[model samples]
Target: MYNSDSFYLIASWRKEECPLKLSELQSKFGWLLIPAAVLVLVAFYFLNPQEKPEENLQASLDLIQAEPPQQTETPTQNPAPTTLMVDIKGQVAKPGVYELPVDSRMTDAIDAAGGFLAAAEPKAINLAMKVVDEMVIYVPEIGEEAALPTAQPGAAAAGGAKEALVNLNTATDVELMTLPGIGPSKAEAIIAYRTDSGSFQKIEDLKNVTGIGDKTFEKLKDSITVN
Candidate 1:
């Protein structure tokens, strides 16, 4: 039923309507156009290949991570000597407290003290006697009478010239009781006193005991010793 004039009119109306619709879309979606453009640029930037890092930078990082820690060296110290103290007196070149190796003999002590004097009686003490801590070695002169006795119990003088003396510092309760006028009670008291006050400095210190007096000390003075 359409004629040529009708077709022309329809084409004109469609062209006008197309232009109006495009204008309406631009006005309503103007803000949406900016956001769409930003999205496209972001996508392009992310998809693009990035440049590789420098080879030297990666190598330096690996070197730092793979490196071993430095070690600190400790210095060694000199060990102290294992030794004992002994006292050498009478007829020796040097007479005083001296340090000697453990298990050293009487001759070793004498040698350490510069040997014996010309008048020293070598028979006064046993040269083979082992020296101990706080030990006292006395070398008497020739023709000199031995007054004090040996510190060790039942051990004779060097030439068996005198009796053995009791060591007050190391004597047991039974040994002390053997002394004249020293009963069991007195011996226990002496041990208790020495324990509280430490070793006796000299034989004369025995008089300092609670029950011992000058008379009792005199009886045992020649028989007792402290070394």
Candidate 2:
């Protein structure tokens, strides 16, 4: 209810005031800046290009599922089949009747007897030979030694010196090498003679072999057998 003059004066003062109104500007824009900053941050979080969470999630799932299976240890197995006893005799360092387990061969018998003497021919015995219960195995001396190396797995320890020898009648080439003066070639000749002719009927009959002579016969007669 100002008087007309006062009202006019008041209106004119307002018009002559500074062009910029600081209070009104501050009031209107101050509230707007805060809301705008909040909106910008929210938009940036949602639309960021560097975000790839699905692959990271899948990798995490793969790591969890890729664990390997648990291990289980196995026990060792025992050998099968049974064993038996046999006699071993020969030029082996230790000759005796061995209580060997079977599925055994002649070589096994020799091994049980502590192997051969230095002069004992390795080729003298048939190693692939199979073992038999109570079978006689004979190992002969390599040379003219009295305490002869010969053995007949059974009747051996006290046998006569002559009995400690080979039986041309029943020997293989491997066993023939056990003779005092025989070797591979000479043994082969004896074998050939045996195959060509029948068994030697007597000591004199061995002379029919090409390699045999009076001297050779003397060396072989006692050692060779007819049966």
Candidate 3:
């Protein structure tokens, strides 16, 4: 029985429905669920762990473990045993080309020249001087003017004319008896001396023997080798 012009329903009374509150507003986030699922699928697609290249890794390890090649050296060739060619000049009786063993010294070259001509200044030449291939050895004699022997007027270029060698280790009773300035008894004395001491380590050791003098030692030095 309200005013007839008022907006009202004239009917039997019925309960009215209330509007939704804060809890119901949560339903709007439901739309975001589909995109969140997509992001998760993409993340795993890119970030999943991968297997390393094991074969390549193993090859590197094998290289490190392998041993290096062993080095080998080849022996050098022995130089052909050479004869020293020496032309003896000056006071020597026979001043000619002499074929001397390698390592020959000045004094040996003089011997090839036929020992000093009595008046030679024996002390003038240093016999211990080292000689080389094709070297000329000179001996100045003191008194008599003897003509030095030259290559025979027409002799072939003698590859080497004469050869001589003295052993440092084993010259015997008569062997020691022949050195210049040495006599048989003195030779015996030399043998005794060498036998008493050990084998000669150097030709210089001969000086220690009673009979060996500066001239003698000088004369022998080039003609001998410890080996």
Candidate 4:
């Protein structure tokens, strides 16, 4: 009975003392806890580094630089057409050599030569034929003998009139070779003579060629013309 009273008193005293001690401790240390918590948050903020503005910009630039540039296809161009020289002679309005595109036809050459004249025998020549370099396009007149042997006087009578005759001034080597007794050498000789002496004024000028004697001239006399 006596011990119960003592124990109750002691318990009451200890409870009051504990509350006083706890209040004092809280008053003294509560402000310190808040500051310590703030310090810990500040240290954490400093330790966890944030990205720099320059670093972010550099990263963006690097990313852009890492990518390949877009490729563009280049357009192809067509090759230019080749040009060639051709001669247009005889009955054409403008008879001379003309520059033309490769694969150009005889009609093109004739057109470049100012077209054919009224007396031009268009049927006597191949107008659709392609013109070549150093080519000669001769447009003979109607009723002109292209190739005839003067030795045969009856043949001219039989034919009524002379057909289209080869123009000596404008005849090509191939065309001159078609004459009687005229080969490649003789045709070249005729071209050489014409080139050196200019246009022959008369049919007798044919004898002036090296190989063409009186017999050769007689064989080609009536068959040839100057105009």
Per-candidate clash tally:
0, 2, 1, 7
Per-prediction TM-score: 0.35, 0.31, 0.33, 0.35
The ten-residue window of minimal lDDT in model 2 covers: 154-163
10 residues in a row with least lDDT, candidate 1: 154-163
Candidate 2 per-residue lDDT over residues 136-213, each given as its tens digit: 455555552222224455422211122345677787775665554556677788889878897767768877877667
Per-candidate RMSD, Å: 13.2, 14.9, 15.0, 15.5
lDDT of each: 0.73, 0.63, 0.58, 0.68
| Model 2: per-residue Cα lDDT at residue 219 | 51
Tell me, by lDDT, which candidate is best: 1
State in Å the error of residue 192, model 4: 21
Candidate structures ordered by lDDT, highest first:
1, 4, 2, 3
The TM-score that candidate 2 achieves is 0.31
Between prediction 2 and prediction 3, the one with superior TM-score is: 3
Question: Once superposed on the true structure, which residue ranges of model 4 sit more than 4 Å away at CA?
Answer: 1-81, 147-227
- How many backbone collisions does model 1 have? 0
Instruction: List ranges where model 1 is wrong by over 4 Å.
Output: 1-81, 147-227
Tens-digit lDDT track of model 4 for 1-227: 55888999999999987766767888878889988999999999999989999999999999999999999998989987599776565678997779998898877888999998999777766666655665545565665544322212222111111223657888777656556446578888999999999999988888889978996665445446789
For residue 185, give model 3's deviation from the true position in Å. Answer: 2.8
